[model samples]
Target chain A: MEGEIRVGIGTDADLVIARAEGRAMAQRLGFRRPDPTLIATAISELARNLVMHVGHGEIIMRPIVEDRRSGVLVIVRDEGPGIADVGAALRLGHASRGGLGLGLPGARRLMDEFEIDSQPGKGTTVTMRKWRLRDDLERLREKRQQRG
Target chain B: MSVAILRKGEYFIASIQSDLSDTEVLALRDDLIERVGRFRALGIVVDVSALDVIDSFAARALRSIALAAKLRGARTVIVGIQPDVAVAIVQFRLNLDPLRTALDLDEALALLELRPERKPADGR
Candidate 1:
């Protein structure tokens, strides 16, 4: 399942859908327990940033596999007034528009890898991923079962 | 609309039925604060077990509800935080100070109950 699930983020209701989709994708990709919850929370924060700041955006989620590690990837993009200072925006307690300013920073902490690209007066795009490693025993069992 | 708010004696219990949008969260916060004043409630119990993800905005909104209720002479206790949701929130490191939480509805109600300090008997 390499297909990407895209959800348009416009209003508050859209945030709910994005979060649910993120969690569902993570679960389908075999993320266990708190990882799915963490993925959902991260999606919530990023999508809220779109609704609160840009008024509109899109979130893309996909399952990715690299070697023995599999994970979920999320990309949020918005074409509003871009962040001038990415560093300040990432800093906790820095509210640019009267928000709690926990969106980007909190999302970064929840995901294993996070990157942001933005140009002033252009737009912003955030890419994040959470990976789960396959245990040696599990891989060996799967291989033996496949051969049998 | 998914939230059910009921008056239990001197407290208002707002039980969330499902995942709520930001607007719904704000509406719940406003409704609880207003009910506390209109009914002269001594406390408010908000049940959030139905919510799978309590992000920064929702958490902040809950805190706002608690703070507003406190200002009106009422205490607020949140209940039924799912285990996975709790783990996610802790990792976010969101400052939830001054917001009381309980395991379930019973615990939340107990926490809201007024328990007077016991006095020692004096022998003459």
Candidate 2:
């Protein structure tokens, strides 16, 4: 329950490593078939955010327990110029910086718990905890489909 | 890159592979839409176990397929939800739950009275 993997890379947002990390980390937690799908999604979003928004950032993953269950805590931090619009960034269907608009908000939704902080000229930090099964997230995901 | 359909009595069961990227899904979308109209299967189950990841494009694509099937008078259900994939839906907060999901291929087929579809019956 105590393993930390740190990645410091220049951000070109290559997806292979992020995807592999997602698979390995999820498997270690005994996460089943489709859960890897979720983790891979979050991993890709965070890694892409690091590479794209932060330009150069780091990804640190650790294990944590939420609601009396095991889950992973993924912390993505970038020392780039930071975000000018934190509120706007989290809004659905809003991506202007080469992302699918799902990088931050998407990662937030995929995990069991989501939190983020950023400054316009400083940096950004995202923390996400994902479980083997989370209800709130699933509900939210389904809601949007209905709206659209 | 794969297709498996199970037939039980009258219902046709089909499960798609997860390796399908956005481009691949686009093609499948068209094929399935056509099949839905042609076959008149009572239901559909798409297996997403192979896809190690999901994004907005993928999420939207799934919805499109479901909509397409519904238009063809078929009720579509998605199957093979890996835990991580579920997490991605939650974390990325994508709009996928409306489509449908199952834990495995067998459960997926069982739910809709379907069997894995492999090929056309002797070219009919």
Candidate 3:
């Protein structure tokens, strides 16, 4: 990850905790500080989802940048049962189990871009990207805040 | 990284001094379990006053340590969570569910009102 944060974790939810450490290390190394908070937060939710739904998964964190700037990309993949309702999962106000009612939605909310891939008994891969030091993206984020 | 132990009533307090990273956390988890495995303390309060940041690795290590202590027949409590940090956990929605949180060392110790240390020959 050039300027983005990257991390990998096991299927076990307990092991997924390493995601936070990864973000912190990235921030310490000067990749991005503010975004790591959201990245780590989303990463934790995805990890919990994997443990709760898939039962096993891996999280890979890397940087995503257009030019020579910095950003964070989190990829959470699982191998077990897959989601049956991708649309419902992405709904702004949906939840599984008892989370902030956010997890997937919240993940999408906190990042610059979010994508999910899943199938019936196959698995799921969630790719989320958040960029720091990007002016246009930052302006769009500010506009979102204003709208909120 | 180091853990300083203290005696409060019947519980022993462990004050950690380090970042509590993965390697350090694993060692702390094991050593605390081993030390408290045989002790007959009514409870053990771990003081984290020295730590500035605790991530999932540290939290899991704390959770494992607590569980290991429970298996050893002693209650475990994590004490002294800074308010700012707690806010961060919430603001970022950091998942510390695996680990138990406490207000301070006093409350943690008071939760058990630990009894006096058992004599070495008593074979508790």
Provide DockQ values for all models, in the order shown: 0.78, 0.28, 0.08
Task: Report the C-alpha displacement of residue B105, candidate 1, in angstroms.
Answer: 1.5
Q: Which 10-residue window of candidate 1 chain B scores lowest in summed lDDT?
A: B115-124
The candidate that achieves the highest lDDT relative to the unseen native structure: 1
Give the per-residue lDDT digits (tens) of candidate 1, residues B1-124: 9999999999999999999998999989989898999999999999999999999998999999999998998999999899999888889988787899999889888888856346668732
- Deviating ranges (above 4 Å) for candidate 1: A137-148, B115-124
Docking class of 3: incorrect
| Per-candidate total of colliding backbone pairs | 0, 34, 9
Better-scoring candidate (lDDT), 1 or 3: 1
User: Tell me, what's the RMSD of every candidate?
Assistant: 4.4, 12.6, 9.5
TM-score of 2: 0.54
TM-score of every candidate relative to the true structure: 0.92, 0.54, 0.52
Return the DockQ of model 1: 0.78
RMSD of 2: 12.6
Regions of candidate 3 where Cα sits further than 4 Å from its true position: A1-8, A11-17, A28-38, A67-69, A87-112, A134-148, B1-7, B12-78, B82-85, B92-124
2 or 3: which has the higher DockQ?
A: 2
DockQ-best of 1 and 2: 1
Top-down DockQ ranking: 1, 2, 3
